[model samples]
Target chain A: MSTTTLQRPATPSAVHLTFGRVVASEWRKLFSLRSTWWTLGLAVLLQVGMAAILGAAARAVAASGQGTLPVDGVQAASAGLQFSQLAIVALAVLTITAEYSSGQIRVTLAAVPRRTPVLLAKALVLTGVVLVTAVVSSALSVGALALVAGEHISFALPGAESARILAGAPLYLVGIAVLSLGVGALMRHTAGAIAALMGFLLVIENVFAAIPWKPLQIISPWLPGTAGSRLMSTDADIAAAQAVPHHVGAVLGAWQGYGVLVAWAVLALVAAVLVLRSRDA
Target chain B: MIEAHGLSKVYGTTRAVDDISFTVRPGIVTGFLGPNGAGKSTTMRMIMGLDRPTSGTVTVNGKPYVEHRAPLTQVGALLEAKAVHPGRTARQHLRVVGATHGLGARRVDEVLEMTGLGPVADKRVKGFSLGMGQRLGIAVALLGDPSTLILDEPVNGLDPEGVIWVRDLVRYLAGQGRTVFLSSHLMAEMAQTADHVIVIGRGRILADAPMATLLAGPGQEASRARAPRATELAAVLRSQGLTVTQTGADTLEIVAGTPAVAEAALAAGIAVHELAPVRASLEDAYLALTADEVEYHSGVGAPANPEVAR
Candidate 1:
């Protein structure tokens, strides 16, 4: 065609921009990418796969010992956090870093010029999606563990400690994801942000937690990665760590560890929003 | 309407956009004309609130772009083509941006059809060609049914047909009593589509006036003349305080009327073979305007860029 003209709608719509609408837009943006689905799916697979193997090992140990090996089914289900957390790292980091890499940040900033609303909306969407996905994946991993361990593990409704432990998996995963998103926003590069986050969550946290030094031991549980994972620890899991020779990590309640992770997320988000507000798109 | 007052942006020591002010009124197309590094895109980005100006204020409609109740409705800017995630389909990207203003899927589909991207609405942007990417960008800009459109290099990657389509589309939008501001380095394109023009060079306003005034340019009539000794004739014309540029081996274009050139050649010893008045084109005016800017911004700009295309 040589040329064409657009016909505006006869009646113009009265658009009212609200924070909820921004959140909705961010939700659409997150779901439209295939990477979001693949990474989340991998998290579920890793958690369930680890649950199965760990459950089988518990059953084998019980058979060899001539005694019942006490297995917390929920703990076995979430045993793969170390591996699955990496998937959430990739997903959350990509959520913001991909926008920067592809130059879509300009379009987004132009649409919502207030700036803070955009990052807040992204954080809200990331938290909501990760919370739901983590909850469902935890349930699936529990089922896998119960199936592999048979009667050796109980899937019955839990006591307070077990309930907290069961809820901890999703809570910890969501915390890590939101934290990663903040880091992504601050770094503004896909590979750099992902590597920075992965290094802290995987190597740095573990290294500080296992060094068997007094100050490192005291500060270890306060690190987001170490403390956040502790959110899924049952009472027996805490006691088991206490039993380890020259234990180099702090012993904190599940909720308290989750609180520490939330603090880290909040601090990162504040920094990200500040940087976003001050920096040009 | 868009109004910028004393707007300026500085990157390190370079003044990307100097303290400049201009107004783009509704019901007419305003062509933002500039050279390759003329800060046209930077100024557009500043208007869109994508880049914060170092000093100055710009407002769209009646308020700053960020202050609008619905920014997208007030102004739709195509800051860059392919400012989209490759993994998402065109429809998905449109829907995502549209959702920010509470726009629904119906409007998204309407824009897809309007931009002639309906067939590839569901296709991932990664596989789209440059022209397709540009069309998708226009669809996004049109999604909100915005009253003001700011397009930076809208025809950058379009085919001939697509280029004509955008030229017509912007003209149509301006005719609808909306404010349409588009930037381009193509002088001929601006001459065809714009009713008003603002020419920029080296981050400063070189000229701003109606299209007719710009083409008339400096109130000088350009005349063409051929002489046996053209160089001697040029020296004599320069002595008479007339601007002259050598166009060919034996021809000179004098910035004086045909009578003035004939009188000067008659007074001199050069025998004039042919003499006539020539119409000044937008390209000539534009080149002349930028040629001055290039000289003023020496070292950074070439002395003469005769090969700068329209």
Candidate 2:
């Protein structure tokens, strides 16, 4: 057991109260809670499980020489990442919304009066955790898949394509996590945030895609999940450009897709911060 | 010290808290007295920045709560019985809050010990009884050794022993020159613990004065004259320009100058069977102030008082 004596100076200096301290405090809070560990564990499980199954299936097809590899080995290895994104998104939303549900958000805001710093701190920590987990999970998934499949499926390591996939996968997850976190702040309810996230990803975006309106088709790639998915699969753009009628690259250039995803993440985060600062917890 | 300047809050159409203002001074326990739904919780929430006021502002020391650097070090508040996640252990909860200010594990354990939670600090909060949860909330309030403390109904679920402990704890905190502001409908408890009192009724300030003054003031003297056949006394007092009411057949309440005056009247050949001075209990005074503003009046008839029936 640890005991702390009262050590506040007779007069506390202003230097001790800063955004840096808030960030540090938020980081501690983010990791100290048990939910963080659970989410990370789920991320790892999904990454490894999805990668192994897809790698095995790809290897069987490649060994028989039945047809050219339908997807790149790296992409196959990272297939599980799509499922793991849900866990990351859930973790991010819960980090803020749970406080609201339990009536503890007021305590948090009281402790740190500058609401933006608190939100920013949470976002930074979420991004850091999600990125680290995504990278490590992607690496392990790819490595394990290669080991199981043998030499038939080979992908260059640290190469431009591999780097893009590796870097972009985590970035995409972090972007999605931020976007969800913003929505969570705006909604201030776990059920509402989760519902909105699912509605946007599963229903709204698809509805937009199915619409016959030409303008809607042009705007479809800007949807949060769609933009994120394309960003993580840069190689798909090159493949679609050669084999498909509707050139994916023309609809949204590689850089343009990345920009759209980042813009969505940033816009959501800004709106969340504005609402958090101006409105009551 | 904590000060509120024209603080008010509105929830849609209902005015939860009106333009009320009061001050809580250091080195004393200030009891915020009100019945249920008197905006006590809403006012406290605003002070903690959990709820933004519709108008005006509240400041601890000289600045708003959010503007204060080292907020945990400046003020500690126990606004709820169990503002904790069930999966986290008591020690973990303390440690997490402590870590915000860069405090070490030692501080967490000290607070656990202080609140008598050391034995169960390792246990998950899910298994805690209501009393244990209240203790944890107090422990969190004490975690920062803050100079200002705000506790809303700190004794709600406490056992007898736990209740006594909280009483002593608040007194001790005040003794250390800290500002302790607490709200409770338990007037007896407030009578014992608070040095000053702030009574709110329907989100408006009904009274703010020293506990001694409030207890010995107008309301107390009026209730002392209630008794059967006291209408004669009311008639006599009315002739003397004193406001009087016959509460019951045997009760005549007189809001006269003082106990000595009422005693003098009885001595001057008044048929006074009961000259008992109705020193208003804190409970009576509180009810009197908030009676009109009680949001949910249970219309169920009161159970017959056996002593009164006799």
Candidate 3:
């Protein structure tokens, strides 16, 4: 064995491209920007801060024996999602669009010429980062609000319900990030993609909801914002249902909402991959 | 070695890079020369696999760039200066690009030092001046120590010292048996650095030969005749089909060798007191070769193509 080893060359024959290294490279690129830190920090703060504020408002109403119902731990912890999704999605969009706007995509493509893997790695990296941050932000908001609104907030939900809601909130956030990354890749422009994303999330679905058309209402329920929120709603709706049974029927069930979101994310990624592979940087 | 065969790129109605073929050999720098919009960048992009050719193929070391096991080791290209995110520090930018090819921190640091960017390596690129940005682009290109370097206008925006540094770097790389292909509109830079030149205009190759051979091709000799009857000498030289222009009261510039002009003067019984040869510069040769293909003509002088002008 020693003699045979001595006859072999000292170095490996070739170094092929590796997905793991590409993902790591993508991670480096994602974190290197100041905007990334600013955007993500704002997302976490918005999530945690809004959650506490809403929890305090709910606590006050409950203490006064007012008309509004008391807020649950899950809902209070996730109150920031309403504001934070904008930051999270915007961060995700900027991750890819920044490269395009600055013409760094050419350098990036020159380095990793296969093209599709780069986009895949970018989406995966964005998902992982957004997931971790979303989980941390969700946990802090819920845990902190639960501590502050002790008597008014109910921790009476089952372990499975609590776990599902807590875990589902981050997953929902991940879906939003991945979907936005796809949109960024597709548009390859920052302001334009962000505008399109906000228009779809803020205007189209809500506008359709008020259209008074039954088929249009069907489209509204499946919109990304509505379906994404439902990932949290399925379990949270159960807690709300316990207090007022009428609220339970208003949401898309947990898996169904996740299914819609996952479908949008998958389809968007598929389209992004196709476009990115075919087009010049 | 980089080899391109019938490579072409068509953007909409414009054939940015029409069917063209050339080979860049190792051990010397090959300069790519073209006027603005002459498809030098497009051809370079196709060679690097950054732009897909509308037809034909280009290969580096007998394989397409994307098909190579380690492409960064095969060729290093600087397609644009500062093709980096403005927010990323130069060090971070190099590290990320280096990571794609499994290059380590040591290699990144070495290139930064090589490009003289060590002082500003940690500064965000947004604060970098154009010269510093060009240096960073070179640093990124040199990361993997690739055998072939394709730089498009690498010295652009560089100060005199920076320009000299890049000239030495490419020459040193080529002297080590690497293939160095670069493009520049600066003919003086090309004349000094390139061992061979492939000139293109309007998406077509106008000349491809050794640097000396291209400079020696045509318009390499002109003669100045100082004669009392300079106007008569100019008329006689023009009748012989040589372009002769009067410079001063007693001098005529003949687009021919001194010996030929002296013989003509002697035949015409014109006493020539001074006959000196004027060497043709590379700029003259380049202009003569690309005279008809220039996209935008100034229209200040005689029409380049009188038929079209009419």
- Give me the candidate number with maximum lDDT: 1
lDDT of each: 0.86, 0.78, 0.84
Query: Which is superior by TM-score, 2 or 3?
Result: 3
- Which stretches of model 1 miss by more than 4 angstroms? A1-13, A62-71, A154-158, A237-250, B219-221, B225-256, B260-275, B292-308
What does the interface RMSD come to for each candidate? 1.1, 2.8, 1.9
Candidate 3 retains true contacts at a fraction of: 0.64
TM-score of chain B of each: 0.83, 0.82, 0.89
List, residue by residue over A39-152, the lDDT tens digit for candidate 1. Answer: 999998898899989888878877887654456787788888888888998898888899999999999988888778888888888888888888888899888887878877
Q: List the residue pairs that clash in candidate 1.
A: none
- Name model 2 segments beyond 4 Å from true: A1-15, A63-65, A156-158, A210-213, A234-236, A239-250, B220-276, B300-310
Alpha-carbon TM-score of each model against the true structure: 0.88, 0.85, 0.91
lDDT of 1 by residue, B1-310 (tens): 9999999999999898999999999999999998777789999989988889999999998798987767888888887889999999999999999988889999999999999999999999999998999999899889878999999888888999998999999999999999999998778888999999999988899999999999888646879999879999999999999999999989999988999899878887679999998988998888788886652343545535533554
DockQ of each: 0.67, 0.35, 0.55
Model 2, position B2: C-alpha lDDT score: 94
The digit string of per-residue lDDT tens for model 3 on B1-310 reads: 9999999899999998889999999999999987878899999999988889999999999999987656788888998887899999999999898776667788888998898888888999998998898888888788878899999999898989988998999999999999999999888899999999999988999999999998888764788889999989898888899989899999988889998998888899989989998866667778899898878776678544332211
Task: Label model 2 with its docking quality class.
Answer: acceptable
Considering only chain A, what is the TM-score of each predicted structure?
0.88, 0.86, 0.86
Task: Report residue B109 deviation for candidate 2 (angstroms).
Answer: 1.7
Steric collisions counted per model: 0, 15, 0
Candidate 3 Cα lDDT to native:
0.84
**Model 1 per-residue lDDT at A79:** 83
